[model samples]
Target: MESIQPLIDKAHELIQRADQLQSKEPSVRSVPKLSKRIKAELNFLHTLQSGDVELKENQLQSTNLTHLEAVLSAAESLPGVSDIFSAKHATDEKGNQKTLVIDVIANHGAIWVKVTARRGHALYRVWQGEGDYGDKDIVEQALEYNNFASSNPVKFIVPKVHVMFLKGLPSEVKGELESVGIATHGHVLSNTDDHRIDVPCFDWSVLKELKVIHAGDPRRNRVNLDVSTMIAMTSNLTHNGCWFDYPECLLINDQAIEERHHPQLTALYDILKGKQLFACSTAITIYKDIVGNVAGPMEQARAKMLLTKVRIVDDCVSKRTQELGWSNKIKERPKIIFGTGDALEMVTVSANGSFIRSASKHNITYAVDLHQSRAFTERKEAQAVTIKKDDAFKRINLEQILRDLLNPS
Candidate 1:
């Protein structure tokens, strides 16, 4: 393309020359420049063959990372088609449930997935996009058609998204998140004392107005508490700007509608009390587990809760055993896990009730606890037990918990 530079300059010169001669009829005076302009136009046309003037373009909107692969698998697995948009059912749940809502826009709207399928079953199915398919269109289809029993390979269509949350955000990983843009005070942490909030904090008042009420001597090395405050306030999910919580296995669903019998939106809201959407439904549970580091997959399956088996292979703690009792009516069966941190550290938890409930902080009370229980088997012995003295007891206990959860001897 650069090779055409001289030609382009000559074209510009000829265009000006032609303009000068326009008032007069074509004559010997204008012949040379007119010929040059025509030749320049011809050259410009030829350059198109090799591609010319690569226009400055922003990145094309890409698929949402979490759902793109799954949707592609569904599309290719079907008889025909390569791209699709659809929602897949979550494997963790039983019965007719919808796991994700995808909107694929390609090839004249190829296929629309109303429900996500798992283990030959389906759930939480809905249509997402320009059409108004009503509420239970897909759900009824799942019940009436029984796509599960069909021999035909069910095709799915899932769209992709380009936006994401701000937490766990990598520095080099670029994004256009507004809240992230607002909290451009401090980029790193220097002793978290500057920001006093929980591990996954969500407070943003300081940065909302982009003001600083507190004062400190100008210190380049000092932590920006205001920025820290905004980061803390960032929600698990955001609409436009303000962030909100995405409850367990759910997105930031709205429950404001009124319905007498089946408040479908409410039901969706109930399922996702404290969670948000990032990817498709196929791997939501897995994504949740890895990020929260709550517990292993097998643990979640066996215990019917997020469970960890922290081992006590190495020497551990004193001759003390404790039991924690926690209950929440909001749950049909509460989350459970076993981890390294004792009831004290609150870091390691069996069933990881903390992460599940805390994924998006809830006002409802949770009673999980650790209470010591004394026994009559106490002995007045000469030798002291070494398990109680080891500092690695936490690590050991975490291993034992996993073993117990996995092997369960």
Candidate 2:
């Protein structure tokens, strides 16, 4: 196998050049473009290094990065593979542009090899002349590549994501590819294990900052839990053997204050239904102030229907709480709970920095602003130290927050 270490070294040098160009003339628009290209090439170089291929400079076009990664991964796993060629479209005698039928060609002794990256489950339709692989059948395309090579070609189909080969590709499709003399490489995962590992879906590092923010002056610093963020946090808690104690009252945005048919109510109901995260609660308090303020008959009816639905759900969840093993946790008293009250009251109470008790005897913790806004590096009521919905979903640490909330000493 040929090594691309020298090319990887060259790519690093190009990155330095691009950086120098940007530093010398930051105002030049083309310098940023050059830097972007160099960055992409550097990523490609790192990908190829993972594949362990001896690559040539001719194989390094930015456009062919995906196809080349697939081919290199296949080459690294397959035996007796040597002298790989990156094929391009060639004109027929008619002078019309011809389609590039094969992405890569490899010589395994006297046999001609063609490699393709089967991106998704659409290959079956593509091969049968029914989809985007064009009007020509994939078998016919393989024959065309063979005709161009002037020899019969051995075909190899590798999945774009190596693990996808195991479950994503249907058995029928694998059989069809093999029936036509095209080898499907599903076992390439072992060779590319380092590259096939799953990446974290959420960034959890933000939790440390969130903990500090939430701990600040419990009254003034409030963390607002939006529907989706609440869902994620509750789901994480459930996974970690904890559950959210049903809130005293479900408080939504100021929109709910005006509109009886606000979508946030429906969203919260759906989250509760889907996850069954809130349990072991007697009943939810629908604030008379909020519900009684509905402007019209239709709005009143919607509010009534929502309350009815939530009550039914709560009753069902309360019954199953013991069976679900949340009874003990429920008895521990919910350290962190979510609800909304008058915005002015929340600000006033926080400003006073006083812990107040409700009729239910739950102590008031600091308030969190779940409304959409940028995070404040400096604590300011104007910036509000709010947790944006985007940041809550994108960044990590809800699990730790749950732990601290449940076991606060």
Candidate 3:
């Protein structure tokens, strides 16, 4: 190609000369010169060969790491794909340098594929150029990979093996691999669009055969507070006077539809429903003191309704012991029941009931005046307060405090 550069430049020069001559007025002298130059450039071009620009076997090409990573990321998301990792060999056994091997551990019956980035893409054209197809060598190497993987201490039953390719193979080649109880699949990573419908390239059939088991988040079933905590929170709300006194003044206005309590209520509901926290008599005392001034029948009825949702723990000593035992068995510690004033004493009796305490070994109790914290602020609504804690308490909002018995950090 380098040798042909001089000739190519000369041809371009001659074409420009011819173009200049043609652009001039149509004189006999100019027409003859243009024809002569055009003919010379044409003859030179004819002497050039296609082999000059063709890539030779010795030519080296670099893999695009960006494209490779994109392909790997997509592969990682494939159904049954897990534990995608890679290793780099500075020098191979033959003394070749810079070898990278990617291992894709997939499960159904537990299989693994070890491949180079270059050969990894079968269904999707991962790079800019042409794709690779199933080869006999690749098929053989895959067996060795599966064998190596199965030999590990981790137990897996890989009865069948499969070779992957970027492009589909001839029926004869597929039959050859199948003869050994091994399977082969051409590219299934690329998506297809037909009319208005779209189809993905993932092989669903393979996953079905594996019988992969899937599950949702485990903690979804766990609410923020337990039954006892809900009862304590309800008892607290009943005692909190302002919460009942300023229902419309605090959150609801002339333009409001429903009570603004749900935001706070729902936050508490989620925490209580999830059983994230434990509650005690201190929390109950705070609630009772907060709402103790309320004597209105409507207000009392509303308080009773909210209280109904709370599961009050039995006052019985055995039931309390049973509840405490249950809370201790879980992996996570129940949230603390926080309060101020007489809660300073870890143990104390109140006239209303036996001394209530957040005493479960698995749970905690924090006595703090959340209202005195910098995170607590007064809302625009004259009677209401806005409590917003940053970072540490970002998720623990005002309603959550009421429900979960957690003080602002």
lDDT scores in order: 0.26, 0.33, 0.35
lDDT of 1 by residue, 1-409 (tens): 4544544564555455445434432321323433453564646435543576552222111112212223332232222222233333333235444354332212222223322211111111222222334434332343322232121112111221212111222222222222232222112223324233322321222222222221232211111111111111111111011111213212112211011122222222222222211111212333344333532333224323212211222112111111223435222122221211111112111123443354224322222221111111011111212122212111121122223322332
Off by over 4 Å in 3: 1-74, 86-102, 114-136, 187-409
Candidate 2 vs candidate 3, lDDT winner: 3
The TM-score of candidate 2 is 0.24
Candidate 1's TM-score: 0.14
lDDT by residue for model 3 over 62-135, one digit each (tens)? 22322233334323333454444433234445665543343444552244443333333332232323444532
Tell me how far candidate 3 lies from the true structure as C-alpha RMSD in angstroms: 21.9
After superposing all C-alphas onto the true structure, candidate 1 shows an RMSD in angstroms of 28.8
Residue 79, model 3, lDDT: 43
Which is superior by TM-score, 1 or 3? 3
Q: For each candidate, how many residue pairs have backbone atoms clashing (under 3 Å)?
A: 57, 14, 25
Error of 2 at 122 (Å): 2.0
Instruction: Tell me the lDDT of candidate 2.
Output: 0.33
Q: How do the candidates rank by TM-score, highest first?
A: 3, 2, 1
After superposition, candidate 1 runs with Cα above 4 Å error? 1-96, 101-384, 387-409
Instruction: Please identify model 2 stretches exceeding 4 Å from their true place.
Output: 1-64, 86-107, 128-138, 149-170, 187-409
